[model samples]
Target chain A: MRSILNITDLSLEELDQLIATAEDMIADPKKYSEVCRGKKLATLFFEPSTRTRLSFEAAMLELGGSVLGFSEASSSSAAKGESVADTTRVVGCYADIIAMRHPKEGAPVVAARKAGVPVINAGDGGHNHPTQTLADLLTIWRNRHTFEGLTIGMCGDLKFGRTVHSLVGAMARYAGVKFVFISPEELKIPQYVITDELEPRNIPYKEVTTMEEVMPELDVLYMTRVQGERFFNEADYIRLRDTYILTPEKLTTAKEDLIIMHPLPRVNEISVKVDDDPRACYFQQVLNGKFMRAALIMKLLEVNV
Target chain B: MIIGQIKDGIVLDHITAGRGMDIYKILELDKLDCTVALIERAVSPKMGRKDIIKIDQAMDIDFDVLGYIDPGITVNTIRDGEVVERRQMALPERVVGVLKCKNPRCITSVEQELTQEFKLTDRKNQVYRCIYCDHKASK
Candidate 1:
């Protein structure tokens, strides 16, 4: 069965196709409403994520499919110590497709291995989050209309930012894409990302401590929050949480059409004042997430309007 | 120093000087019932210094552990005190139940029954990542 455990699972063509489908969905929502009429989506979230869980549930609902499964581990059989493999196997018997989010990395991979139906990894610890990358991709595509020759400056915690990692991995596949990593020394992008993704592809990228230095050069400024949950040391999280804040002052040198994005659930990493700016596409990213997810669900289910 | 030739077993040669003990410990050579000899810092013409291991019984060996620890090491199968076949090691694409994922956030840490697996992601760098968490394996 096909499962999206990582963003790399989808090729560049598939990404463009998904983007095209999402755009078409936006233009004609009623045309695809009943595509997944009899399908059932099981959202197996072992972690608490209101946004991602609801997004999947809403996507299934909007596609005329019913949604089942629990919101958190506590509400599921996982709390009673049932394995993800067994749970997925049981849920596969009920749901046509599965969207799983777990606190442990590779839990969805285990589920995908055991599950007979298609599996979608919503979020897997600090590891892969393919769907979030899909949302970011669609948002970037809609705004810029191209991934080529775009300089993306990713700021804040890149070390544990799974979304940033996934996006970088996805974007590196495109030609003429450059990355400017803006983060504190402690939370810089991992070496594997540099070695495995950038260096191998000969993709041009630079790491900088200050975002202001690279602000004017970026066509896309992807801001990520320094999540406290990802940090083992509370003091370290506190120190780096406010390291890079995107304010209106920071945008003075940025391009007028520069698209600013966040994965949402922001905590002071992006100021509220910047939300009114025409370039702030984070909220639109959320709405695009639903559409992209709907397109993904349809593609995985092999449903046609 | 000279070690006796095994009538039937295997000979491990050309291990990097200091990593013999690591290979020995990881392979649990001490648990073997048959006679085993570890020659560390042995004189070698090819290598400035090397380590060699001799086993007295023909038994199943975990080649993944051997390949992971020292891919350059040579393995010679012995029969009737004669070298029958020689093998050169390469990093296996995937190894299972050999190394554990140390990352606490890995699903294998909680799911004890799950097999601990690692994939050789970077051959140039000799980097193996835990298949579950993508955490780089530290040698």
Candidate 2:
């Protein structure tokens, strides 16, 4: 069975198809409303998540499917020391598909190996989050209509932001996609990402400390929160928390056609006033997330038409 | 000078000097009932100095571990005190249950039952990343 453990799980053709399907879903939501009827989705979240968990639940619910499973580890068999493989094996018997978010990296991979049903990694501890990338792709497609020759600026906490990593990996596959990585020295994008993903592929990229210098040239400005939860040292987190806040003044230098994005539940990385700007596409990105997820469920379930 | 000769066994030769003890511990040579000899800092024209291990029993050895520790190792099989098969070692594509992934968030770190696995992603750089978390295995 096919499962999305990472963004690379979907090929370029598949990604294009998914994006097209998402656009279709947005155009006629009622047509695909009952596509997943009589199906079941199990959300096995072993970590605290608001947007991702709710996004999955909402996507499944809107598709005429039932949703089950816990939102945290304490409420599940995991609290009793049950393994991810064991938990997924049991959940597989009950659900048609599984969306799992765990604190442990590659927990979904463990589940995917054991579970009879298809497993979608919701977010596996600072690892891949393919669905969010799908949403991001759809948002980018809706705005720019193409991935070619686009300057994508990713700002703040590139090291710990799994979204940035996944997005970089996905976008690097496209033609003429340039990246401007803006982050503090301590939070620069991982070296393997540069060496394995970019350097070998010969993708052009520039790493900088400030976002404002490259803001005007970008087609998409992805703002990520500098999360304290991901930091081991509290003092380091406090020092870098406000390193790249996207204020109204900064947006003035950005292109008029620039699309500002954030994987919401954002904490001060993006100023609240930026929400009113015509370029702010994050809310639209959230809606696209639902659409993309619905399309993804259809694709994974092999629901025809 | 010949330290010892094995009738029917395996010989690990050309191990980088000072790494013989590491290989000994890794291969658990101490647990073997058969005779095992470790020659450390042996003079070598090519390597300047090298380590060699002669096992008196032909047993299953982990070539991947040998490859990971030092790809320069050469293996020789002895049959009736005659060197029959000679093998050169290179880095394995994937290693299982050898080096533990150091990433705290890696699933292998938490899942005690899971065997730590790493894939040699970059052969040129000798970079091995945890198969589960993509955390680079520090040499």
Candidate 3:
């Protein structure tokens, strides 16, 4: 069975089709509500998640499917020393599909290997969150109309942000896509991403310390939270956390059509005042997540709607 | 000075100098009942000085593990004191259960049954990343 363990697992054609399907779901929600009727979705969230977990649960509910499984590891068989493979194997027996979120990277990959049903990596520790990429893609597709010839600016902690990593890997596949990586020297996008994904693909990209330097050129500004927990030194985190805060002043320098995005649960990185701006699409991104997830679940389960 | 020739076994030749012990330890050569000789700092025309491992027993060897550890290694099969087969080794496209992924958050670390698998992502840079977590294997 096919599993979306990484964003790159989906070809550009499949991504386009998924995005199109998501748009269709948004256009006519009532028609697709019963697409996944009688299907069982197992949401195995081994990590605490508000938006991602709820989005998966909401997607299944909206699709007329039943949702089962845990919101955290402590409540599941995992707390009793059950392995991910065993848990997925057992859950697969009951559920038609599985959406897993884990603190450990590759936990969903392990689940996918043993699972009888299709496994979706909801979020894994600083590794990958392919569905989030799909949501981001859908959001971008709705706003920008196309992925090509766009300057996507990724700000804040690029190094540890799995969303940024997955998004970059996804967007790089499109033609004429340029990246502006804005981060502190310590938190710059990993070299492997440049070497493995961009360089070989010949995607033009520039690295800058300040967001202001690249704001005007960006078509899409992807913002990520710089958590104190990700830093070795508390002082460094404190110093960098405020470095790229997207204030009203910063938004003025950006393009009028620039799409401001954040993988939310925001902590001061994006000012709440910026939420009122017409360009801020993070909230819409959350809704798009539900639709895209519905599309993903339908596609994975082979439900034609 | 030439070492004792093996009658029928396998010979790991042209290992980078000082890496024989690492390869030996990794392969657990000492546990084998047959004679296993590690010749460290052996003279090499191409490499100047290299290591060689001569196992005096025919057994299936993990070439991927050998290739991962040292890509420049040459494996030779000895049949009746004659070198019947000689093959040069290169890094394996994928390695399983050989090198442990150091990433604490990798699934292999938490799930004991999961094999520590890595794929050679960058051959020019000699970069191997864990297949599950994509954590680069440290040299």
Best by lDDT: 1
Model 1, range A1-305, lDDT digits (tens) per residue? Answer: 59889999998888989999999999999888888999999999999999999999988898899999999899999989899999999999999999999999999989999989999999999899999999999999999889999999999999999999999999999999999999999999999899989999999999999988999999999999899999889999988889899999989999989999999889998999999999999999999999999999999998876
Q: Which runs in model 3 stand beyond 4 Å of their true positions?
A: A228-236
Error of 3 at A225 (Å): 1.1
Order of the predicted models by lDDT, top scorer first? 1, 3, 2
Question: Clashes in candidate 1: how many?
Answer: 0
Candidate 2 chain A lDDT trough over 10 residues, lowest sum: A23-32
For each candidate, give the TM-score of chain B: 0.92, 0.94, 0.94
TM-score of each: 0.97, 0.96, 0.95
TM-score winner between 1 and 2, please give it.
Answer: 1
Least accurate 10 contiguous residues by lDDT in model 3 chain A: A227-236
lDDT of 3 by residue, B1-139 (tens): 7689889999999999999999999888899999999999988999999999999999888998888889999999999999999989988999987788998878888787778889999998889999889999986
Task: State candidate 2's TM-score.
Answer: 0.96
The all-Cα superposition gives candidate 1 an RMSD in Å to the true structure of 1.4
Q: Write the per-residue lDDT of candidate 2 for residues B1-139, one digit (tens) a residue.
A: 7777789999999999999999999999999999999999999999999999999999998899899999999999999999899999999999998888899999988897987889999999899998788899986
lDDT of 2: 0.91
Residue-level lDDT of model 2, residues A1-305, one tens digit each, is 78889999899999999888888877888887888999999999999897888999999898899999999999999999999989999999999999999988888888998999999999888888889988899999999899998999999989989999999999999989999999999999998899989998899999999987888899999999898888999999999998889989998888889989998778888889999999999999888988888888888999966
Native contacts, share recovered per candidate: 0.91, 0.83, 0.91
